[model samples]
Target: MSEFLNVNEIKEKVSLLNLLNKLGFAAQKVSGSEHFFLSMLREEYTASLCVNDKLGVWYDHGAAGVSGIKSGSIIDFGLAYWYPASFPEVLKKIVEYAGVPLEKSHDIPAVYAERKTALKSSTYQINSISETITNPAINAYLNMRGIGSVAAGHLYELHYSILDSKNKSRNYFASGWPNENGGWEVRNKYFKGCLGHKGMSFLQGAANRLAVFEGFYDFMSWKVENPKDPASTLILNSLSFLQSAKARAKQFASIEIYFDHDRAGMLGSEEFAADVAGSVDCAFKYEGFKDYNEKLTAGLSASKKSLDKPMIFSAENGFGR
Candidate 1:
């Protein structure tokens, strides 16, 4: 077997829920990291597949339990889902989707704790936030995304430096959006990450209805299109804040969600709608585009084409480690 098929390596790094999402399996419901999905291998009125995102494992109670195999790693789940596909083929496909196996570190929980610690001890610091769009790279980035200067003003220029896994310091200058926890979600042509606490950012307005977006760029795109729309805006910098958004929704009369059209996004929209009464999925406006930014950049002509492609990550080569 190839090194990519290393069972322990794949089990440690790849998120089963993310894998299922990338494979076009939308969860019927998500609670915390546990995603309940209708089994892809069999037809059923109810969901029997559950994936634990935190553990990178899954359980198909209906099928696996019949054989006294109650649970398994992502590899096992993939083998069952892909049916006649040989073990090698399924493993290869998983490796491609998940990127190279991550280097062995501490256990999942320990590593998670360390990541939180690293975030708290970040060497990066936000020097300032300017309304000006002076950086050519940032300005070009916005232009490429079809975000105008006026809309760009909503984002700030961030200055920070981070040490990579090798402990080498590197500086960065990117567009930043401030979240509620006073952290910055930094983005540029080459990088995407957060600098502080990860949470939602809201723009206070007089409207009783709130417009929820998956990212600040999407919110900016919506602003470019509906500058006068007075609906209060909420941008979940990440989907983990969806529950928090649901709780916040009680304060408003209704909410209009504009999430991406990907499997995760579509499934999250469903869960969000189920949690918040009078919530409307507004993603239909984008139609075939992946997200609002994509719709903006691709234009009407591109919308005619399909965006149903596998989820590709920057870490696909060797960055996953």
Candidate 2:
């Protein structure tokens, strides 16, 4: 039998699991064909995906109108809508989405710990990745002081092996937190950070108060803003990490979430509020922009526990990282 392309390869061709994974969407099983969509309405996740290994038919329960696609085709729609302009390596992310086998992967380089990098690596790749971080957009993203700033700090690039679209051997640099057991949640390009309460990101004083942020940039920015507000902080990194992190964070009497203000952030914030509503002394919302970094870039003020109302931390006056 001829060998089939692996998960990374399949993601390049389409975004079945990739799309769902990125959006934190769950797949719903259908009768004939296999297809899935991120359903905000779905109650449970794994249950949503209908993977009939026997018959490759996937269907999404929450989606309406048109129907049916293999994981790859699903990615086609996901990227087209979510990441228009489709960064060069995005298609490969799609392949990784489908769980297909990829040619290679990458790991961190040894030369990093001694440097305060002013420049960014050209691209980042994953071990078993089917693409490289060489996309012009990715290159430019690497150049951004924002992405590079993190690079020079706690985050490092994993210079793992990979197979580019040409199927040639190559290495990719994926951004990862310095600590072990930390998973990832990327914001703007080249900016990778972890969201879980894993590691010491939640180190806080004895006060029950806590600060929550959605991405690394914003988390860094919050510290820049609240230089004097000595409290515990948690960076969900991505909206996806909030739920699990919430369960772990309940130990504190108050948890203030400074998540991104985008649709995803808002959704996660609501869930967070619901999760810790009565249990915690307070659950605050950052009235910042769609994202903390953006709001800080736009010049917002740093503050904690707004006296004007309950849990509204506004960055309207201008803040910085």
Candidate 3:
């Protein structure tokens, strides 16, 4: 098999529920087409993770306040379930669990054939794109991330549909931005995925300096803090595009990297700094937080708390300054 993996093909061919079963996780309860199970991610007395068998999606009700994703497609679940695993590794595991062959084969298994037939019609179609974002949910999500004010020119309101196995289309909306390959990097509260070919987003600025970020939210967070920055920016959208981003950074005299503060982010930052001379890892600015956006949101929360505090007119410490 080639090193390249067709992610969409695997998603279409694999059965998420079947994979869960293979992993020794059975649904604690079943409600119509939805199956409820204890979160594979964390221990819980009640089942909070729900797998919608009909739509091939999962959502963990208890994960909203936790780090990582709360809801997404099967691929997203795989990545979250197998935390710290590379994308290729996750894909291989999914294929293995689903009993699907990595390479194309004429002698397909019966179970694999049934899954393919059931999911063949599952697809995401873009219905329309609006230059301005107006959806309340999208706006709330952006504001929650402390980027609503800066997201105006950088994002769009995307109206799309997901075609299910029964040939019924479910309409949804999200905030999206275009990538270099003319595809969209879309995100809402519950979903995050590319609408087409995944690639990095490059924003033109200074020719001598560049700032690289792992995702668009981090880029926007930096913009929120530094509105006057003149450096050219590259949002990798995914760490898998680090090699391409590094090659692009070589043209600039200086590069600033703001990856997450996790193990993978630290390794990526170190690798980029090693390959490209004059490159610096700027993740130290958000050292304790996961990423730039997390730091930004924390700052916003702190400011809100300060504003809400009651003032005392005592002489102690000059009336609390």
Candidate 4:
């Protein structure tokens, strides 16, 4: 019998890199394979942090001090793991996530554990983020986009914290990965595989068109572009998830992958296409944008901004002629 793990089932043993990989992140390649750092940092590319799914030990090409440890501490510290109330009710959240028999949920006691933190001597609060998000820095970020104070405050409440992922308390923001119905944004939470339902039905009958991208955000961008003739979109959250999406592609008469124009995106898409050539009728390809988000950042049509941001256009690196 397979022993099921609850939210409290010794997460330290849960291999952090493996879990992060499951959640759709890869080793930051910007460091040129020198150290196994999370790809969350804004950089070009780095695969130094390779996950031996079985062992979970990470090594960098150059950065020496980091030895691979089981990911429990990493999850707790990297993701700001506290008691349930701080975020959503984590017990319910985990049960909804793990799907390991909800009846057994009450048996787990640690979910009720209270977190105690030492007060900081700086201008920021450690966890009571409901207050700290309104500072000038955060507000300035919100103001440029014309986000309402209340909505910005809400997003801040969830993501407005200084997370110390690689050691320094860097102020960061994050959100979602909470449900099976994918959204524009989600957190890296799925540990074993895709967090939600794995198998999606192909569009049968005359409409055999296909669409695939790295995630929901890109999917939405395509939808916005071809509202009348957009094909079904697939979410390849990370290259690792591409395998699962490949399996799902079999159901479609034809499939098209809109992977990023970057190296990893092309590699992952091409690999998937090669593997599924026998099953899928047609596996299309398109990689001209960094992502649909990048397309949106590029102002989509020389005149559009992310919806929440009131600015109709932006000057992101790739945007504008």
Candidate 5:
């Protein structure tokens, strides 16, 4: 008779990466000892599940953490695989797979026992935040991009940094927007990354109808364009936030999506429209441009160039000649 085996026994003995490989989940991407895969349970374009071979842990970022599971041990993964299965059944299946005897035990692995962190928070530290845009580089960057002072005023000047795979340090000082996970989506001319958790940034105003933007810059540009008619807004820092945005869109009577004029944006808009009955895609207004900000910046740059041109009057160049 196959005896029962503890969760720890499975985790300590079973190699998750190897098991995944054997099970035909070849890693889609690898960084150092961590392997990323495009999730076995769902259809997605990007790899979300991360298996850390060094720490002997796996993190499934599928569903933007809405699944309520991120990092876990092999047994926990088994439970996700055989969802709604009894613990005894899960244990038995693992035992049969790993060729481990079902020795009765109550001990679960420490890795699986670790407390789950709030999925929304990210891994970056926010050293400082200010209402004023004091950094000259940031100011120039924003102004050059045609993001007005009104939009800049609402943004926080953030001091933050992110570490690479080798644990190397790269710091940045940029304008930041706070996401639902309390992470700062930091951006400057030179760098772009998140500090803390990653999710959508929702700003509540008048209800019923809401405006959605793919990036904070577009949201701010929208604000600059329509300061008086401020309504509820959702800033999806990335298309990855599309699901979370969809969930949030339910509370509003209608939604206006302002995504880029790209293939991903078109697909995302279609999905959003399908999910929300009254959702409107406002991208057509800025057609032929990548985004609203691009149009705004291009218009501003063209005006500046026109003004910079010297007044040269000749027979060929007729200006009321």
Candidate 6:
């Protein structure tokens, strides 16, 4: 007979923070008891997923589970993270990744309480925004994603500081771009977040046509490939802005979507197509890859490997000859 698993027991044993770290996600920002992270559940440029370590709960401001619940316990996170996996499987994976033995009693450490009290009041402040991208680290990050050349005009160098209640401050830098509301969608290799109000990034072009992408990097990748295509562009920044993008997309005669090939992206593309009359689902152009950036990087890698090799996107697939 198999050992029966108690959901409550598992929740108590696992550390959500540790589990997230193990899953390759670290808190990009923290305020009081809330820790913010780039939503692993979806492609988002901002940290919409906020986890309250003290309460041992998390919520994705960008999206909700199939049940429409946006916030829940670690068990809920496990269920959503390993969607379609059996309950037992999710529990097992959570335990394995969290590295918590079932038989042991896991207690919340004193450090958490101390840190919470120390950072009870904190604020993230934007120190400066540069019109040019000059940081070697940010440039390298952009280059690694195959967008260094094109990212210059589209992104900015942002210097920001996080100050806790104790008056201690830590300054950081990232490459960023602005959304419609003047908020900065910032990104470094290790972090993804927004500096102010969260919204979409739009670039004006021809009135009749528009191209939509899930994130800025995907838009940059598309720009790298089609430098002269004059379609007006919108980077949804986060799929949370899908409805808003759809509303704006209706103004154009044609719309092209370049969302990821994942489930959320597929559904979002379908939703956009159904809602907007002339929208085209261009994700098929990079079908086997996660997103346009990934496909672009793969092609870049392949080119470095063999110059004569054909690029990943060819004329027949609607990527333009």
The per-residue C-alpha lDDT of model 6 at residue 143 equals 92
Clashing pairs in 5: 3-102, 120-181, 120-197, 121-196, 121-197, 122-196, 122-197, 124-196, 208-253
In terms of lDDT, which candidate is stronger, 5 or 6? 6
Candidate 6 lDDT, tens digit per residue, 2-117? Answer: 55456677777687988987765667689999998877555565678999988999999985532233567887787566643445666778988888878533343464334334
Model 6 local distance difference test score: 0.78
Show how many residue pairs clash in every candidate, following the order shown.
Answer: 0, 46, 0, 14, 9, 0
Tell me each candidate's TM-score. 0.58, 0.44, 0.62, 0.41, 0.65, 0.60
**Which candidate order results from sorting by lDDT in descending order?**
3, 6, 5, 1, 2, 4
lDDT of each: 0.70, 0.44, 0.79, 0.41, 0.71, 0.78
Name the best candidate (by TM-score): 5
How high a TM-score does candidate 2 get? 0.44
The C-alpha RMSD of each candidate to the native structure, in angstroms, is: 18.0, 15.0, 12.2, 12.3, 10.4, 15.9
Candidate 5 or 3, higher TM-score:
5
Residue ranges of candidate 3 with Cα displaced over 4 Å? 1-120, 311-321
Where does the lowest 10-residue lDDT sum fall in candidate 4? 116-125
Q: Write down the lDDT that model 5 would get.
A: 0.71
lDDT of 4 by residue, 81-103 (tens): 22212222433444443333533
**Candidate 2 wrong stretches, greater than 4 Å:** 1-153, 172-175, 178-207, 278-288, 300-321
lDDT of 3 by residue, 210-315 (tens): 9999899999999999999999999988765666678889999999999988876887799899999989999989988999999999999999999888877776
Q: Which pairs, if any, clash in model 3?
A: none
Q: For model 5, give the 10-residue run with minimal summed lDDT.
A: 115-124
